[model samples]
Target: MSVIAVLALDGVPGPQLSAPGLAFATAARHHHPVAYEVRICAGPGFRSTGGPAPFGIDTPWGLEGLDDADTVLLPGHEGFRAVPPPGVVDALRGVVERGGRVGAVGTGTFTLAATGLLDGRRAATSRRHTRELARSYPRIDVDPEGSAVADGPFHSAAGVLGGVDLCLHLITQDHGEVVAIETERQLFLHLHAEAEDTGGTTSGAGPTSGAGREAAHSALADADREAAHGALAEAAYNAVTPPGSSLEPVTRWMEANLHRPLTLDDIAGRAGLGVRSLTRRFRAETGLTPLQYLLRTRLQSAQRLLERTDDPVERIAARTGLGTPANLRHHFQRSTGTSPTTYRTAFRAVVSGMTWPERPDGRP
Candidate 1:
């Protein structure tokens, strides 16, 4: 069996630590025993700090626990007030050197990046830390807009809850697209299973939903968190298309032609429906008109490109069908409350480092 080790820091989030084991464990049971063997390596002790629960527990193994694992995960934790302990950094470095997969959830990416493992690699963390990341780690390409990032053997996720999305993506990469989809369908049980499957959540602080999650996150409120993140994953999955609807064909066409300038008439013709009928059905099923949905998806793609690539805003505007850079910037600022350049500079994770100009407001 391939071993999967979860490395938990002293103040790691509880849900973040549990997420990998739950997802992978469930997957292994439906598949095979040889599929995975998961273990929690508490560095030196099993402890909860800055998590849902508070208490330190003991572990059977220390950093050596990761020595031969197939995958090593670092769940999200509070950022360091000082340099990482020597043992933690050494253990993480060893895992990568031995060809084991390495992953971090949320601010845990800081630990991995600090180890210099992510130097010049594409990585991601929660959006709140985006600018701090760019200013702190200059060489690493931190993808603020991405939910998950796989650079070589290092797999990094946005935040605590993003652990689930990252794990699902990892399964797809390790197994196949079919298995990944099945796992996603199962993971949706927490929210609205059997509603629709959009796919996964984007990168940021753990999702903003659920009483337990909010209470656990002293930084955010419970009601606000649940409402914000409650629909996101479902939206991602259901955004695929409603079953038994003629709109599926049109949806696929739109996704395929995101770079093309599309009009409602063009979409209606492709779906073999009139403009009025298409609009009505699209709204009834997807809760979005074809144009509205198209704009949102295009914006998402544009955001990703801005963070992960060196391509200019003008070029990204053309690819995402947003037309001119000026128009793209206007919409981007309106939607995300930040400029494209600022967004790109903050969330991109780097090991080598880059220079970030000080904001007039003095943010990263």
Candidate 2:
């Protein structure tokens, strides 16, 4: 198993402290996923100051814990606006020199920057801090739009919640999209599971009707839930919304019915518009014509299936409406520069890694 050492400084945000471990632990629960040992390594004065009632955190390890870590994560501290201690900076640089990776959350990027390792690398922090980070380290490219930014051995997140995004990205880099998406699926499942345990509340809506279902969908959307939420989420969403719901968006209908032989007229009819009007509206919103959007949706669905299943190419063809194996291969090759089989083979376990586990086939 790989060790993930979180170097917690004083006043580290509560969410940032826990999110990376939650993501890594969930990833370990999924099929053939990487096993990780997450350790909280803090200094003598370390404590939580980001919440209303601050509390001291006791851990078994210290900065020395970072020495054997596969990845060292730095969560933002109250004093991040100033320089980090020389010991901390030297320990971080040593990790990189030894070929391990380091990531920072929110203002914690400033702490990582102090080591001078991110001097010319692209990094991300919250939008409010982008200007400051750019001015402080002019050679670093500060991107505010990405959920997370990775440059060589360094990684950074935009906000507290973005620690989850950064950990997911690092998981993808160390493992593959297969494990990353599965990790996301587990996280979202946990949210819904919490909701269900609390009596299936739909925020005052009655437990039974179109109004209730609509509220549920809205909640999912608020959670940033997408098809990436995996099969359980898709099934639950479909159970509520279904096809032909008066309030259902046309694009959503397209997503649910990717297995169908849909056409321009089919899509336009869902939106109660003519094909021409549908084309214009879709182009304006998604930068793709209705048919073009459908095509992209089909290919996206195919990609997900390719990543998540053992179903053969012929069945994948029918499922994505690509029609036949040859047609699917042609489009897959055109879009991805590879065949579906080859794509799956490569995506399944890229291992492709900082002291990660050996391949399933037991290669070094």
Best by lDDT: 2
Q: What's the lDDT for candidate 2?
A: 0.67
Per-candidate TM equals 0.51, 0.55
lDDT tens digits by residue: candidate 2, 79-155? 88887865898899999999999998888899999889999899988778899989998989999674578889999
Tens-digit lDDT track for model 1 on 81-154? 34665588888778878788888887878888888889999998888886777788999999977578898999
Q: Please identify model 2 stretches exceeding 4 Å from their true place.
A: 160-162, 193-364
lDDT score, residue 264, model 2?
62
18, model 2: CA deviation in Å?
Answer: 0.7
lDDT score, candidate 2, position 44:
39
Clash counts per candidate, in order, are 27, 0
